[model samples]
Target: MKVKIYPIVRTAAVAVLLSGVSACSKMYDVKPQNVVEAKNTYQNIYDADAAVTGVYGKFLGLAGQYEVLNELRADLMDVTPNAGADLQQINTHNVLPGNAYADPTPFYSVILNCNDVMKNLTIMHNTQKLTDADYNQRWSDIGALRCWLYFQLGLQYGNIPYVTESFSDVNTVKDQSKYPRIALADLVKTLIAFMEALPYKDPYPAANSLITTIDTYPSKMFYVNKNCLLGDLYLWNNDYHKAAIAYKNVMETSTPNGPGDSYNYYNTYTLNSGSDNDAVTQSAWLTFFSRSMQDREYQTEWIWSMVFDKAFAPENPFINLFANSGGKYLVKPSQTAIDNWSAQRQTDGTPYDYRGINTTYKMVNGQPVIMKFLYNYVNASTGIPSDPLAKNGRWYIYRTPTLHLRFAEAANRDGQTKIAWALVNAGIKGAYDDTTIPDPTQRRITNLPFPYDFDARKLDAPTIRGKYHRNLGVRARVNVTNLDVSLQQNANFLAMEDNIINEDALELAYEGNRWQDLMRVALRRNDPSFLADKVYNKLLKDGNPAAATVRAKLMDPKNWFLPFN
Candidate 1:
């Protein structure tokens, strides 16, 4: 029982002991064990700091399952022939209690870690070693993380036990009866309150210095920033206008040079000022996902990303399951994803969208495979790990483009079509028109143009909708005029909403948000037909009746939330 808590305690002890160890000494030589040592682990501010870091470690550990459960059920992925029964169950939307990916224990473990930190936070601060600013930052960090975990729990397994305290007795831990599951809506309200109390920025020390020397790659936005969770909560709550505001606040306050760094986005990634095939565009795209931020010194566009170390943390399983060198390679890109990127063309029709060339997927033995998370760790030509043991790369939770799209979605829902069009266009144009590119011709990716200035009287709404939806390949099988007519009526909003849904698929595929993206529209519009029309129609397009049955089961609102393990 205590062993479950030992990792957190030992990690803290290591952080404290390392302060006195010789610069050449390894910190892992001494490790703490047992309840007494765990009780005494955080006797100082440094120890408390380490415990807070442990919270992040726990969060990172959940990324693999988190992504799998979120993505596999969505349409972007297809279970490979090599995928095991567990993976198959996920792809079919038939998750069972024993499925490792569906287990809630890892997420609960993170909650417990946060509880442990909150319990001891005061003692560390009262000792005078911790400043008020640092204390507030840690408070926000712990609260936002808890809110995020709870939000995931609400989305995945609705009606989760809302535990906020640590239990020292192993025997007492078995008492689930004491902590009954709360409704998802009630839990979301609680999460909103918890997150709103947090400051938007950590605003202490230098910007890039928010992270420790040991974790040089993480953005402070990953921990201290709160708006990502706030925006997520608002979006889920159907507060579209508020969600737009929340996301806008984050974008405005965000530093382009990563969360705490001094540099802005343009400086951080340095838009490639070269030809479409130039090394600059290639490097910029690669560096955005790679560790060391392409040596830019900070994360510019990444809102929050997980950190990994070769010796301690688990490597990203997305890489492990997708990289050819990763052996298992259990998941494959759907034809939907392949077509989404490949179908794009420049105004002149020259296969103009190179964003897909090496950024998202690439041909391997004449089979198109996902390339986003694979490129940083594996060699493109050989399909082998650049380093057999390489364990680090950003696992994105939020980034600039997704936020842009979300804002666009919310704007469209609010009846601000011009705003929606402008946002969608800007997000795409921004990606292609990066001034950092030395050659303007090299920077272009899509033929789509920005929305004409907002004039309802002058707007060609149907054509604009068609262009945006067509560019992203999101329209349902229905005709454009039909979609446009549906767009005009509040009752037929799902047809219109498909535009954002498809855009999300096109722009944010395989990033672990697709299921929620599907659920969001489904839940908001109270339209289970979306589940049948978009998901099953495209995902089960191969004519599998069994898959069709699973889609029917999934359409039931109860199945929208995951089962408890």
Candidate 2:
């Protein structure tokens, strides 16, 4: 009764009246029909703005591939034998059948959206509603985005269709498309030009609206950003000098105060109780956390990320198909990885730096049962059993702790040997200094009181001998009570960059990145040990015994690059 006026009804009445007026207008009927009108059915700045928003919406389904692809390329998990799934099919060294044949479909989807945007832009420009400056700016932005997509496709698939303009018939383009592979060098140059021409000064806003409503999606994701793309391309080209410069540009411009306050790049560990312990305590500067298992939004650290919505989350067929709890698939870490961590350690007597150590070992019916990925534990006294092994809601993957050791390697690669050496020494010394010894002789201790040690030799050795024993017997009869002395000695021995890299290899073993790191070293120094030890051994274990007999056979150069499919 108080003269209520419903906004919805009032708006509908106005819309109907406007529609009637528009229907009778000959001028409106004479409007040119271009791609924007043909596709979006929207005209004028306001409607075109909505169209742009729809184009932006495509990004919501385009992130997360960077993490997945990077992790797969790293030495984390080998492709399981007879892996038939798409991820396995690609990872297992098979040649792609055609341009249409790509592992993750999102790659194609992104390209399609970019093409659509370009087509719509053409139509919108024809309408003459937008000024030359407005059209040029939007065109440049669209071109930049398309260039980025093409660059990614070229990097991943090598030979991919360079689709710039959009076609009216999607099926015709799809069927008649003869995708040509672009040269890496040429592709890099073109991408560089595209990125260089972009207006970095008047860049887009940040992606996170809650934190910064002014931020744009392109600015948040590395793939979309010019500086980030340049940095990544340079890194891929092995131009450390240029890569460092580009990365530094992003680092400096993105966060002027330094990585401490702004960069939330922390090592987040989720326990069996669903509690997370962020060890680094820094905001993530490189990656972000999102609710979706497959689609992750850009964190503060993310330079770029492919977005995925609930409807379009990518299915990693390799991880899903090959990773078996029992014996359904052959996906497993190589024995070399197992042996590498078995005897490794930090200078501080803490176990080696592996994230995914086999932790759940228990005696069952007087027999020791070795378990991996099992989280449930039984309290015999309280009769309370909790299954930690059960798959929780959070996405699971090996997360590497940001250590000074990696910085040392990066510095070394950048030819800052002095800084590299200094960082390595500090990291080693820091590890040694931070290590704590329990019982002063028999047991290894951590910040927590679980008596947990990942080093196999330390874990397996009987505590009755008054000290844990090394398998090598090099330091036999050494007083374990003097942990400081032992740690100091270890640090001294591992002070060199070479030794530190070895330690990194052994310590960070199956968590991944080993193969690529070794490859980088190989490229730099022509060291064959990476393949002799890490890559070849896996092949040898899988019935290629010739690979094991080092003198009997030589590895193919093709093995250096991962097979594309």
Candidate 3:
């Protein structure tokens, strides 16, 4: 069940050569033949840069991990009967050690790559080739990526052996006694301390950003930005006050075109125009997962995304699971997910949730197929449909809406219900209408002001011009209906909390993060029944007979964390 650290040297070296993908082809195109060659690889900044890129390449190959670990366990998705035994196990919470998705080796291998970059890059930096700022920035990037690996491990496995240095040989790795598993709480504390010590900024200027060679790198608001991880850790650690502050920094700095910002939210594609068809209604959100916007560097909302170049990196397996034309269509939307959207109706009896409108599955005869991962659309210019085999969608690690929602959760927990309500409102409004609207007076709509700050004041302004933003009949401003009245209003606050949770499910559907959201609320309230009830309800709605068993197990805190092996 534990990752053998010493034997990893051999495995790590093989992985680097096998997966040594880089955005800057000139530097990382060639893989090191041996550990000596790998050590020699970082002779200068170029080599150091290549080493950094290799770490990212290792991280990028985890799109499937996000889908399985983060999403599949949650109620948003149901496993297709023929999806595979492994995927079905994940859906049913009957995962075995042999489950293909249970392999933590890839994540451990990723940590090894980060360790390699940290060691070699430091050696090269000591040579004075990199400026102090450059060295710190690059080192910080490596540290953040390593922290990301540990964070994922902590979530997947309750506790794991914490290792900082690269293993020398198989003998060292074989000695489990040398690397004892550390509690996730302790690991979070360690990461927070390490991250806080580094000279960092939430939204580091895009020009001096890390991973400089890659234009599409999530230099703007990704986990690479320590604040993102800091917020995540703080949230997991239940440090609501600190978590709120961390998330605030992300909102103010990392938001697309926010104060002192430089990178676009997403570059290649624009938001949905709210056209009368699925194509336009889903465009703003769907574009983020489309192949067309994979590497484009323009106006974007992608806080951080895994880069996958069709011509450069290996094929993303997520495409095989999510995409329709070329995918196995293994994962499908659950009945609960369908009901989540169906329950919410606009004034006109239409779905008020645009995301639900676009993300829900449509029935083909008797079979229901999820379309969130299927980005098959007709090319506007080429006049041809997109290829299903195209693995173009970049795996989003963090985005503006999700961050806003996270901040809302933290804020709500900290009793800043207004701020929490505002965060949720912003996510909903901006979800489908992120297109840059002109601010003639340089104010709200035109200036593209940060949505997270909307709760600062109580005012009724003209809503953005979109079908989802207005009342079809009245043609007046859209009323914010979901915001809670006040914290003293217990029922209202609970309703707001529920709204935020649903919003997370709505905004972050198949991209991964559903189960964790449920866990966060459950743990925060110290109410095992809360988590159990929700999961049980979803399972029953889906007609799964294991609902009672899963509910009983979930009532125990130990069962909160999935079994490592």
Candidate 4:
């Protein structure tokens, strides 16, 4: 460098020196990737939040499908006689042993997803830099979700694989596959613990406020955060004392009216009224109306419904297949159910019977030919009719909302005989007295069409033929055209079990929990209803079309308890 001639050479030598830098030096000098950067590559707070959302998503997915399982258990719909050679495929009566492919399978799938979320939430708490409060809240949310999943599984399947933690490999599935049937008492205990640990207040109330309120008339009321679940857990456990307390909490804290307020009721028309298939309408009592048939969203009656959206809907094979007319499959209400509804009556004037109600017969030249699911469509914006016969009807196969039956049962169990008696009396009055015939005059003409003087041969036999011939004759004698009087004596013969069971069947018809109720009653008392004799004489009458087949089906002693695969 001292020599002016060497300046260029010095610069060149420095450049060559820089080019010869060691790999270790380069490594030491490089800055390590920070947590934020690593999180970008993996899951960060936002990603964790998304995961929690997914956990909730599974809840929604399962809600709608529950209705189907519940309905099947209730024996409201039998396997369609023409369900093809794959007769074992149908799940009704005691025919679900070899039919693990039935609706209950999805319920387990949901439980797995719930288990994953709960496990991941723990991981997120340990690995992520979430605030203590945030972590606790999220943890509580996951607990609540897990509680619900387990509760449903227990209710539907009795003893189920209780997966509380996440799996690292497929082999873990086998390890976690302990199907020890959790007793209802233990299930309730677990549910209570989870509910107690969860955050009762909504974290994001405004954004999720639609999840909070009844948007319309037949409001689908929901429990605030965990209130409904708590109540339901108690109800299922037959802890009516606790259930009443929980239900009372919801009554005091949430919705249109307080403790004494009437609960809102809804039907398919109100539930799926819009083009967007939005269930936020006033009529929704509780709903699971998401793209994912698995997730039951917009549950008005639900204390907390699993929230599914366009991003995820449950995969429902049967609802669309059976409920939709356009589809190849058709699962109609059993003739027994039809006859039950037609024959049932109420002590009061209201129709407690839902037979022949809301059923659709196949349409030939616009005339109903077969009583199938009533297909209707509504405008997306106004929630008004677009097409009366569009197959766009959304399906919600499960309903866990509280029913008048619950109250009736509570009164009966608690020895509130008068109250129970009144409830039963009212229900009986409602079933028969309530008819499609608008006026008393019309009802008289419809039930006993033949006038006192009308010729016997010309009269059409009553659609319902039973012990009521003399009653019909009496009405005809009195010229008792009053619809109110026509139903006065109908439900009088209904006993306590009959009232509760009938109410459960009517209110929760087509929902998936009936089998559990049937099982529970069977276990507690050797009631004729759940016994083989009952099944034979009542469910499978000798002259019934599928009597022999049904008898053959139940011959398997193991059919009583569902198979665990």
Residue 547 in model 1: lDDT? 68
lDDT per residue as tens, model 3, 310-414: 545556666566433455667777777777766665435555555564443455335665554444332322222366444554566776556666776776676
Compared with the true structure, all predictions reach lDDT values of 0.58, 0.37, 0.58, 0.40
Alpha-carbon runs more than 4 Å astray in model 4: 1-49, 56-68, 81-106, 123-138, 155-157, 168-189, 196-204, 207-225, 256-319, 345-356, 359-403, 420-494, 526-528, 531-558
TM-score versus the correct structure, for each prediction: 0.77, 0.53, 0.77, 0.58
Range of the 10 consecutive residues with the lowest summed lDDT in candidate 1: 473-482
lDDT of 2 by residue, 1-565 (tens): 0101111222232222122212212212343442123333434444433333333334333322433343333344445554345445333333345422244345554455456655665677787766555555555555666676665555454544455555433333234245454554577677776666654322343321211111122212322455545655565566766665664444334331123532222211100011121122111211122222221222322333332211222322222322233223334454444455545444457553322233212233332222221222223222123432322111222222112334444444655543334323332122322235444332321222111121211332444221111111111111011122332232433234454455555434333345445554554555556444554555555444434544122244334332334
After superposition on all CA atoms, what RMSD does each candidate show versus the true structure? Answer: 8.6, 14.5, 7.7, 17.9
Q: Give, for candidate 4, the lowest lDDT window spanning 10 residues.
A: 1-10
Best by lDDT: 1
List residue ranges in candidate 3 displaced over 4 A. 1-39, 168-175, 202-205, 208-223, 254-285, 291-298, 347-349, 360-366, 376-388, 426-492
Better of 2 and 4 by TM-score: 4
Q: Is candidate 1 or candidate 4 better by TM-score?
A: 1
